[model samples]
Target: MTFDRQDLSNETLLHLYQHLLRPRLIEEKMLILLRQGKVSKWFSGIGQEAISVGSTLALEADEYILPLHRNLGVFTGREVPLGRLFAQWQGKRTGFTKGRDRSFHFGTNEHHIVGMISHLGPQLAVAGGIALADLLDKKPKVTLTYSGDGGASEGDFHEALNVAAVWQLPVIFMIENNGYGLSTPSNEQFRFKSFVDKGPAYGMEAVQVDGNNVLEVYTTVKRLAEDLRENPRPVLVEALTFRMRGHEEASGTKYVPQSLMEEWAAKDPVENYEKWLLAEGILTETARHSIRETIKAAIEAGLQEADAVPMPTADIQEEIADMYQPFEAPVTDAPAGSAAPDKRFIDAISEGLKQSMERYPDLVLMGQDIADYGGVFKITEGFVAAFGKSRVRNTPLCESAIVGIGLGLSIKKKKSMVEMQFADFVTCGFNQIVNNLAKSHYRWGQNADVVIRMPTGAGSAAGPFHSQSNEAWFTHVPGLKVVYPSNPHDAKGLLCAAFEDPNPVLYFEHKMLYRSMSGPVPAAYYTTPIGQAALAAEGDELSIITYGMGVRWALEVCQDLGVSADVLDLRTLLPWDQEAVRRTVEKNGRVLILHEDTMTGGIGGEIAAWIGENCFEHLDAPVRRVASLDTAIPFAPPLEAAFLPQQRLREQVQALRNY
Candidate 1:
């Protein structure tokens, strides 16, 4: 397709040509390096440079772009330092992720780039979130996120588009139809004629452009982005591009037909754009050679600098330090006198969320039925009226997308709290929570300051789907804080602490205890240190380490049996108080670890192992654990009672104390 320049300046046209050429040259050099075994792997954007370059150049400098692995032009167009980009690809300490992530998997806030996770569609939802922040902040900013034709089939694609359309978020969902998702052709990916056809289902406007035409892609995105900034709505732009090379350097193009390759090769973005530039008298052979030489020189310099940098060392302390952003709880004096009104566990959580929303203007609450219906547990009751619909959002039943949006908000330095409704349903959003949110901070130094409120535990007779004590799931993942509070005071304080934290926190609230548990909760805002365990009851005979509903069970069992036990409420499972646990284990020679989760993979096993390893000499008896049976939570009250450690816990404590 021949193109009008859209009155683009000569300098602007030249700039576009340089960007298109830069990535092509970089890919060539990287391919040589890959052949020489210098770089491990490379996902070449050799023929599809126009889509990334044009789309990136079209956005405002501050506008965020979530690029895919093949969008090398996006980085070059953004002018990210070649030295750092090469260092990242070379696995050097000077890279953006400090050698933790490979290729374009890392993001830099300085460049307004949110990196892509290998999971393709989640980033689209995150883009919705970034756009949401801009909308809330009243900034004329737009977010452009890329997806392949293969990614278009993901459930996240539909969820993200629907959410963006419904909320009128200023986002551009760019589908780069590159014909294959790792050898699977677009024909097998989706039945729809084009991604643009799917837009109407979400009430979104979509357009298709010649992805290989630099001017066409640039003009199309520029118009859409300008419109979005003023109008603040989502638009779908499908760029018809083809992957010229294999998925990566190691993957040969044997799967791709030679005829198909020839067709796309004729329309190579770099070659076509260069031809157009020369034909338009916008560039000459001399200028083209000079630009190539300059880019080549820059690439060599970057490679030299990256080669000189050392690889990440095996320092365990440094590795641990980089896992999470250090957070210090702000100190606040306890309220004088014990005259505070007693509040239910649910009410305590409500108050904490309300207070946090008031304190952090950028704080947003998202969940199903949260705004008008106050959430399933009514934790956000009357929140919409008090904080407005903008802050208290009612999300669709898209757990994965909602969780991803929360991460996006955090990327923009905004705080977000997502309510899972039921902890068991977290599996739907597990990838976003575990992969994106959990690894974000450690991988890219991007603090995912998100709190996912998990209404957990059994005894409500809500069956397996609604009732689960799944804190152990997040506790096992690094870069996440797992907090399971037992009582009203701890719930409120811990929720506040999680809100103030700089990392992703899974705050598990026991559903059974929501109404059944109550305690004097201070009206004043305060934070409970996350990693500190509370000595709920002090005794010398035995140490009972527990959390959530297990705390109450242990306390009640000890009180009923008149057993002098040290009841330690490990509110934070991820960074549970090791020192406090050791002290209690030493003071009381017997140890019993308890939790509401099933026995086999429950967190109790980890606690028991830690005790055996660290407090073995202090133990008077073998470390014992009391947990639910290793079976799905039963519906019948009798079976559930048996499944939980209610009667068995009492028996285990008595048995351990005697031993």
Candidate 2:
């Protein structure tokens, strides 16, 4: 049977066929290494080689792609060197990720490819964000994103599809329906006749094609991609294929039927295409043989070179985030002095976003109810009118996908500031933030200049879902900056700093302080230096270490008791002010760590340990902690106040004074 390629020349078809062999041969060598224990494990897209290479051949060299765990052809077709590929696979220090990541997880800015996570669906939304950027900039580009049938069932898939369609993003959402998720078949995952059918429901042009037929995938993608670059419409192509291998090397895959495996083997994409190539006189037997032999030898040489490189030694520095890097942009005068205009903390944050967007043209604001409604807290009030809708977008309630889309946009050199409606609800998108956004910096030295705005802390009976001070969650993570600013000055300053720094930042804004607190806030651009603490009140007795609303409480209690104390407000959490803590503790001879989070397993423990080691000799009393009781935040106002740390604050201060 003859196949149609629209207008692809024989030479292009022959070249595409050779591209197919590259990944196949390299992965074949990888399997050998896995068996020999030279490499860790493998996630092979072995059986579906044609779709992998053909779709890649269809796109322009400069166009962007966000690939999944499979699709090794993406790297090979993009001209990522075989040695770097093997070294990364072998977990060598010479690898593209510098031995920081495993599997097919690395990216190069030169190629404009963003490596994917094992939880594959987030990349779909990320690609949408990138497409949004290209659309805003009026660049002639189309983003190609990959997903699996099982991944299509994920919430991120629908979220990504909806956002892409609503915004009219220039992205092609390609799903490789490989018949299985892991061990379970697609029948168990979804009941739809075809995953492609759901795409139109998301307002996208959808199509299904035989993925094994290289010409079919190439022609379909090529036609859609050409239109996408100019028109900026999102399309969904479901490539019908099957996974001949298990999910990974260790996964036995005994669940697959022998007859089904045999059937797919008969229709193997590589073998089927080779016959078509020879029948059409597109490639000679000698040429095809030479292609395999060339790649095989190259893969072998790369493996040998990787073997010669020493295993990377462990470095503690990699685990610590680069939080305090000096800003690349020129610094305006610091927004200090008591003569500055008085403003509420919430207003300061809004002004900061406004000034930041004005200073940095690429700065974008996105979140739920943030555009017209001014967000749930009104922190982004009037932003849509001032910056226009494109800069200030209202996203669907897909929290994880929101973060995922922001990450994708950041990969393309756009700065994104996303709002987590309530800090407690950020858990919905935790995987994308921690795994994808946080790791990108250390893995390949790629900075995700994304800032996640979290309205945190419990007050005003917002209860369990709306109120939570989960700052410790991010402080424990590597390659992430945790900023919890208390007063209006620091809130505006640190937020500007978060925007300037080239890293992922979790800026936690306390909900309680939004309306209740007021202080001098400068209108001009400035940064509250990260990795440092501010002295709220200077005194020679009793070191008070606190952050967020705890700062307010500490100052109030100290003034109430008429005690002379050194109150230190930790502006940033991850890189806490250790120097300030040591000096203040040594000078005062007593200490108290205060926070609104629960007592057990809080960040206070880390601080206590630090004081124990560094300034043990200078302490007059044991370093004490005053935090909320160990209980879920209650809904009732009285219960909530009782559960929080008001009683602890008064008792801890008096105890330190008596000591």
Candidate 3:
């Protein structure tokens, strides 16, 4: 272990040189294709090849990794075919992920690489989750993650590190400190002496190394990998490297001065590794030339293969295109079971959670103040008493970690229910939700049976952050199922339905109505169908399409204003109530979509357009919408009154009256 270059064997030297050259040649070939307009675009990992290749070699076969956009070296090492990589760049059928994922954001089910995401910081939490699973299952595996120094600034990066450190998870966070993050230099991004130093604050081991020296990276990671395999815990390693090319294919060297480029060029990892191999008598001139020739041939062959692969068929595209597949709603004559008496919305959620927990023993619920505190809304009250701490547990005030752990548990095939203390604090775990849990099933096809309970919506003067309706954000994503329940019956039914669904569901329970709202629920244990809509009224004049609390508001307005408005409550957003909407528009001949969300690009507008396109002849009047103004939810009572659509405003019946 003494500091001596002589300690390295010729075989080790040759391997390092070969690894460095692999990515370099790939980068060169990618750029050539880019110039020829054969490949769409690429983010060159030309200079940072050693960092990816060496860091990846450090990982065990069964271990996990969350690579960034620039880590093609890792993909190559993982045995992802060069043809698939080329196909991805060319946006062809042969591409991994069927050309849906980015060129660098590749995944392989057989290889166990979960895939890359464009979002910067969320991978930290996802990696932590994988490591958490290893800890829980007593699996001898580590999750190695690579994020740039710029990505280090993301709240998720800090949050993930803190969670993993506290839990002593088997995660190795490798920061590829390439001096600059796109245009911003390290001096501007951070004040720390080194990114590695941040690890100690989170109660984890830290190390920094010459990222250019593939040997240094390999040695550091190899030791850490062994440690993780034995006694799994968190470790942070910062590799000082450089980006030889522009940030992306669209960018150019105009941003970087020639002098600075020339300075870093002198220490090229590919060239330096080659020199090191020659000095160690590992790789001679002939072998080096042969390796280069081999890589060149492989890349050319891959491109040719990629060019030949058939594009995905339009039929296949049409089949999976719609993420939100509305359930074929069953005929709703009263069930053969007796209806349960009225119960509080809160009570219904608690009952459903309890029943769900009892049914699925593996399902665990964790969040702050959830144990004795029973959650801020008391929805999870008495859960700890029944299931104990391991299953029904209280957590630290780290939202990221809470969701991260839930994700890990879900991937391990344990159903998980993670509640944000309040919908407001979900911003703390936004990265985990938006990037990891939401896309887990779509990206990896690893069924993430997780439900995120978010108490959201306005009217209780909880101010802008706490009372905001934020379902629009989750609805935009393809894989997630967003649900909002307006009453106890729907809440219980939808909550139960969420637990039964294979995809991750965002179960948003409006806190304002939780204790107040009560309705008739069936006594029997059953799961309400997801993606189905409940028709509140039969009307011919107009269709008031709504969901969540909007359903209640619309019903009230319809009764008060004497408007023949047919109201529908969509219990799910991803697989929305498309048929219900279609039937209502067909019957009513007029559509007036409504929601509490902002008017711009809200679900209401989407539904309106769908009806307009499909049921154009059914219209008696122009389709209208009543929604919150396109502004942030206000804090003051008066301003908030103006911002949110009042029931009085919706009561006008003008959209129908005008018809």
TM-score of every candidate relative to the true structure: 0.98, 0.96, 0.86
Expressed as tens digits, the lDDT of each residue in 1-659 for candidate 3 is 11234476766666666667887888877788788887677888877887888888767766777788878778887767888777877767667555555666655656656666777777677677777666666788888888899888877787788878877888889999987878888888999889767877888899998888777888889889998889878899998888887788787667777898898898787787777667757778899889889888988898888889876665665436433223343433336867788888888889889988987877888788898889888888888889887677777677886787776676566788888877878888777777777665544456567799998888877777888778888888777888888778878878888887767789988887887788887765566677778887777677787777787788788777788777877777776888888888888887777788888988877888888788899888888888888888888888888887865346546646675
Q: In lDDT terms, which candidate is top?
A: 1
Tens-place lDDT digits, model 1, residues 365-457: 999899888887888889988999999999988999899999899988999999998889899999999999989888889988899999888
Best by TM-score: 1
Winner on lDDT between 1 and 2 is 1
Error of 3 at 431 (Å): 5.5
Over 1-659, each residue of candidate 2 has an lDDT whose tens digit, in order, gives 24685678887888888888888888787888789998888998988877778788889998888887788988888888778778888788888777878887877777778888778887888888788888888997899999999988888888889888888998988889989999879899999999778877988899998888888888888889999887888999989888889899799668999999998888888888888888888889899889888878888787788888999987776445432232454465654563578999999998888888998998888899999999999988888889999899998888887888787778778899999999988998998888878877777767778899999988789788888889888888877889999999999999998888888899999998999999988767787887889899988779899999999998999999998999999899977889988889989989999999898889999999999998999999999998998888999999998989988789879988998
| Reference-based lDDT, residue 69, model 2 | 73
Candidate 2: minimum summed lDDT over ten consecutive residues — where? 318-327
Question: Which residue runs does candidate 3 get wrong by more than 4 Å?
Answer: 1-14, 254-263, 282-296, 310-341, 361-366, 388-414, 425-448, 522-524, 537-544, 554-566, 586-594, 598-601, 616-650, 653-659
Better by TM-score, candidate 2 or 1: 1
Write down the RMSD of candidate 3 (Cα, Å): 3.9
Clash count for candidate 2 is 0
Instruction: Please give the lDDT score at residue 469 for candidate 1.
Output: 79
